[model samples]
Target: MEYKTILVEKRDGIATITLNRPEKLNAVNVDMRLEFLNALDELEIDDNVRVVIVTGAGRAFCAGADISTFESDPARIRRNLVNLKREPRRILSFEKPIIGAVNGVAAGEGSQWLLQFDLMVASEKATIAWPATSLGMACPYGMIRLASEVGRFRAKEALMTSKFLTAEEAYQWGLVSKVVPHEKLMDAAIELADQIKRMPPISIRTIKEAVNRGLEGYEYTYQAAVNQQLSDDFKEGVQA
Candidate 1:
């Protein structure tokens, strides 16, 4: 399938998915979300591609959701919400390590995407922000991932205060695995991918599965989705 908002490139054992909408700092809209997932789906099935790198095309990695694309049509909104209920975490359901090559600012949903990645390599200049509360919105996914990564106290503070984390801060918080110069972000991510590629594939997959199994609590994010879906703040956020 042709993708309008993302680029999928395969080479050696690496498949790179580049978010292509730099105009809006790779803010995910309907088309981008669909195409991004489609790209990951293809990579997942390809045995030759043992590792995947997700990055943005331009300066910023991802600025978050495209608020302008929030559906004003009630039917469309309801349909979307219903779909979310079914597939709340349907981004990249792949076994291979998906490395986040964070090149720049990753905010809101961008930060959420960062959390979902198996490993994150952030550029020194990259900034991570979960300012959803400040925007009259809330990121249930980010908060849940935060509690899973860090402790509950830090998650509560970060979410409630709309704390914007620099690359160093993200590393300190154990959000990203590595931090490198802006020019070396992709290089670092690729290096990590290659390093992991040498391990026995089956063993790697098993290890990943075990780690994910321990985080079964993420399933509770579905409840958070429902809570946010029915919230007045979410409505105001979409409208704003």
Candidate 2:
């Protein structure tokens, strides 16, 4: 399959998906989201892909949804929101271990997507935030995942303030497992992926399933409405 906004590369049992919209800071526009969902679907079936890693090509991991493509089409926005909910749920259901190698800033919905991953590693210079409240938007996934990963109070503060969490701060809050130098971010992620690849593939898949089952209990259902606001242009923008 051809992908315009993302790159998928596989080697040594690991499939890496890089958000390729560097000029847009790899933001999750409608097209990118569709392509991402397709790539995830493909990776889930490819037996050679024992593990998956998600990151971005440019300085920022993902700046969030493409505001430029989001305007005033309520029906399209609803469809986009539905896709947002469905795609991440599919990602979380994948049996293979998935990791997010956050190369830079991850904000709004971008930060929410990281919550679906089994593990996360960030560059020392990376920053994370959920600016939905400031943007007059509600972050359904963020509200749930942040509270579960950090704490309810912290999540509330983060969301309400639209604050940025530095790499070190994120580590302290348990958002990322490791923080490496920016230059070594991919190397560190690959090393971690290699380690997982060395483990028994079946056992890794089982562990992932068990962990996801346990985490599923913490997910809040109220955030489902965030998807209701995604634009139609964004939804149709997905590349196949």
Candidate 3:
């Protein structure tokens, strides 16, 4: 499928999805979210792609949702929420291992995406945060399984404080697998993907499935969908 918000490239059993809207710090607009899910759908059935790498095109990994074009109209909100549900569902359910090449800032949904990735390789310049509370909204995606990654208290601090965690701090908190020099971020991610590719394919798929299944979050994700729809604060936050 042709895409405007993301770029897809395949090489040696590895597929990379680059969030392409650099002008907006690769922030996800409605179209971008659709493109992301479409790309994943296309890649899921492609036998040649064993592992996937996700990154952003410019300075930031992704700045989260694009509030400038966010919708608050009731009808549009319903449609948008459907996509919101699909975004995390697709990532969590994808059978192949995904590596996050976090080159810069990853906030809000960006941070949420990183949390779901099988492995996250952050650059020295990268920063991760969940600014939901500050914006008068909740980060259902972040809250779903963040505690499993970083301790429960850390997850609370992250979600409630709306502060940025530097790459090293994120690493120390167990948010990312490793931190590398900015220039070597993709290399580190690709190298890990290659390693996964070398492993038996079925083993890789089964292991990923087992690990993801062990985490419980879909219930919270569903509830968040309902809560966001009825939330005046969420509407105000997104419009701000």
Candidate 4:
């Protein structure tokens, strides 16, 4: 499927999806979300695609939900939650490994996206943050995922404080699998995907299934996020 807001390239059993709104820091607006999901769906169904790499076209992996789109229209935001059909669990559902090449700062939903990747390679210049609280919004999945990654205390500090984590710090916290110089980000991610592609496909898929099964409730958590879009805090936060 053709997309206006994202780019999908497939070659040698590897598919790369570039969030293509660099001028907007690749923020997730309604159209971008739709195109992103379409690209993901296509990649998932392609037998030629063994591994997927997600990165941004320009500076950010994703700046998060573009509040500017629906800040004033709570009804529009609510409609988007239902119509966008962007089930976060879909990322976990893909049998192939999805590697994140965090080329730059990942803030808000962008940072949240990093948590969904099966593996991550970040640039030395990359950073991650959750500004949800400051924006009067809340992301419980982020809290859970962050806590699962870096422990409860550290997650609290990061989420509550909206602190941006540098590449080294994120690696130390176990959120990033590897960190390379800014220019090496894609190389590292593709290298990792190459390694996975070399292994037995069944073994790889089964192992991924096992790991994801161990972490159940993704559906529940994602639904909560949809519900959150209707909250007064979410509306106020976005408007603010």
Worst 10 residues of 4 by lDDT: 80-89
When 1 and 2 are scored with TM-score, the better candidate is 1
Clash count per candidate: 0, 6, 0, 1
Give the alpha carbon lDDT tens digit for every residue of 1-240 in model 1: 679999888888998889999999999888887777677778778889998898998889999888887765556766765544333255434678788999999987778887778899999999988887875656756767778888999998898898888999999999899899899888899899999988998988887666655445555665665566566777886677
Query: What is candidate 4's lDDT per residue for 1-240, written digit by digit as tens?
Result: 778989998888889999999999999887887777677788878888899999998878888878777644567655675643344567667778999899988987778777867898999989899888886555646766777778989999998899989999999999889899898888888889999998888998898877765345545655676667767877777666
| Collision pairs in model 3 | none
Q: What tens digits encode model 2's per-residue C-alpha lDDT throughout 1-240?
A: 899999999998999999999998888888898999899889989988888999999799999988787656767666666787686678778888888999999997789889889999999989999986665555766677678889999989899898999999999999899999999998999999999988998898888777666445333543445443453332443321
Tell me the lDDT of model 3 at 78: 68
* Residue 60 miss distance in model 1 (angstroms): 1.0
Candidate 1 Cα outliers beyond 4 Å, as residue runs: 73-75, 82-88, 214-220, 227-230, 238-240
lDDT string, candidate 3, 1-240, tens digits: 789989999999999999999999999898888888888889999999999999999899999888888666778876777777777778988988999999899998888888888899999999999987876767777786788888789989888899899999999998789999999988899899999999998998888888877546666765675667567887776666
Best by TM-score: 3
lDDT of each: 0.80, 0.82, 0.86, 0.80
Score residue 120 of candidate 4 by CA lDDT.
88
Q: Tell me each candidate's TM-score.
A: 0.90, 0.89, 0.94, 0.90
**Candidate 3 worst ten-residue window by lDDT:** 214-223
